[model samples]
Target: MEKIAPVRLSVLGHPQRLAVFRLLMRRFPDRIPATELAQALNVKPNTLSNYVSALMQVGLLTQERIGTSLRYGIDMQSARETFDYLLLDCCRGRPELCAPTSNFDLNNKASKKYNVLFLCTGNSARSIFAEAILRQEAGDRFNAYSAGTTPRAGLNPFALEVLQQKGHDISVLRAKNVSEFQAESAPQFDFVFTVCNQAANEDCPAWAGQPVSAHWGMPDPVKAEGTDAQKSLAFQQTYGALRNRIRVFASLPLGSLDRISLQSTLDDIGQLENGVSA
Candidate 1:
């Protein structure tokens, strides 16, 4: 094997590169586009390009071509190897002195269950997809719900079709107004996420528990002007985006992060451009 330890360490030595690597690691399995990364880091394009190229060249980052965009993610195995190298022989033959990676699980049952609410202009496509995906992925750790400023008469047919086709239960899904959740007896949300630009920018009723909020704006698949197949593709893309975002959200150490840090992290996730196209 090549002696990549030095190369990996060198790649991570720069502050900007390290920050980029850490950000990618936060999204782990999800690939983040260059534009999102640039925005998150608040760095110029050339600077980010250099940092990204260095990380990829050293196997610390991996990039995949999705349509016309290049999405980047951390090389998890390589990252683990780097950690292993850093900790090697540091415990004086005492395993307890070193942190055990085997016991770490993001989906541990002992973690606190958070109630999450997703909102949009209409309880039709994006919000519904987010609710279903979050419930399916981390239902044990999160109570996922969806509402809209103005709900449609019924759930979007395309949304239902996509959820069902992906093996998600849609029987319990319904299009409901945001006012329903604002009632006195409604569940107090721990986090409220707006999934559409319209809902994000509009005035919303005060949620119980004073939930932390973020805007994950996505293009409305319902507004997609194309053939049935193209519209289906749009819905599928939205599903992928929401699923990826939820996965990252579910993996967060909610109990460990304080309100400010958690809020910042949530906002960063919202900035991701995973499935914005439609």
Candidate 2:
């Protein structure tokens, strides 16, 4: 029997490296200043310089200097190819396996479209963004919705602005509690992602069907403060992170693999970014 090796994208152990990589991958084609990244992660300049140097050394990041400022970004095309290599083993010289691996029924599933629910505690920033991000990112793939276990009175306005800046029309977004989707009355869900630390630890709504659940806890961007520019920057930052993950999710192979293999693919999709990690 031939055993297939699992995909490996970024070096996974250190949370700091993951943070920097996630930031870099969050916005492709647009360079983020190293100074800004250091501030965002609450690290020192010298320490962040070392991280950038290491990532560039490993071909996971690229840096350019303009005057006194240094900007860093992923070489998105190559970065995504690196991730594709891990999953499809294409760079290992097997082009055949790299082709689309289908598992889901897109045509016949008109009657059975998968639903996804994103849960958080506040329903203000992170969960709201995830709902918009997934809808815009995977519009045809799944029906994505968001609700907080402890719902806020209204959706975060910054979240709305972030979605608008990303070119998504989200006039229909609103905040509601998780009681809206309880087991006895909830719509069946195929996946559930909890995006807040509070909600992940709380007793969650009992999903009607067994959904593939996970957590992608992000710091509350709204909780961050400063000038309007500073707060807006925070929303843009968090929006970029969630958007990257959802992009990877939308590109997944959907027609050829068995259900078990497809589930593995979905799990990997969340862990791996569509670009370089460092």
Candidate 3:
């Protein structure tokens, strides 16, 4: 069996490499293109190449060629082995202190799946990304939707490209005005998040459920200019910011926390640093 070694530790020791690893883990079992990875990390292609090579050499990451793209993914079996190896002799046979994996219930049931809505000014990029991220990450526990104060004619192509590269299904997503949800027949939402500054400050229709709302302001990637590379990078950063915040939000214990605590936690998640770790 492969064991955790100094080499693997060294490979992950670099902050950027570690960040890359975490990003891949967020999309576990799915692979993303190398170009997309570089864009997401805001690193030069050459620099990302070096990091990927080092990680792959230590059996931490795997790559495959798909058409003209090189897709990268975490080596889950190797990762699990490494984690087990690290905890093998932890706490000197005291299982309690070691916190053995089996000690915790992995099947705790949530009371119900929550309905969530992501809002923005355009519903073309930031809100779109948030909707996709939350749906993909917590579909079993949340019904995710997105809308705009002033809907765009269509989805942003760059947003679709970035989401496609990350293996998210973009076929059914569309830009719609928030008035659609304001109708009495609309599904009652449990949570509502505004993912851009303009939407957060706008006058919103009163939701049926009076959903707890919070603002998670992220830069508008659709407005990014310069070279194609720069635009792609901007989209990637926006996607990353939404993915991280959504991940944190999805992990909250909704069945246990009261409304005040849940609202506080939601606000805290919104306060997380945009496009970077909080």
lDDT of model 3, residue 23: 71
Candidate models: Cα lDDT each: 0.81, 0.69, 0.79
Worst 10 residues of 2 by lDDT: 1-10
* Per-residue C-alpha lDDT of model 3 across residues 6-65, encoded as one tens digit per residue: 568777889989878877764444567888788777899999999999899989899999
Q: Pick the candidate with the highest lDDT.
A: 1
Which parts of model 2 have CA positions greater than 4 angstroms off? 1-112, 254-276
Instruction: Please give the range of 10 consecutive residues that has the lowest summed lDDT in model 1.
Output: 101-110
Give the clashing pairs for model 2: 21-277, 101-256, 102-254, 102-255, 102-256, 102-257, 103-254, 103-255, 103-256
TM-score, model 3 to reference: 0.59
Candidate 1 vs candidate 2: which has greater TM-score?
Answer: 1
Ranking by lDDT: 1, 3, 2
Better of 2 and 3 by TM-score: 3
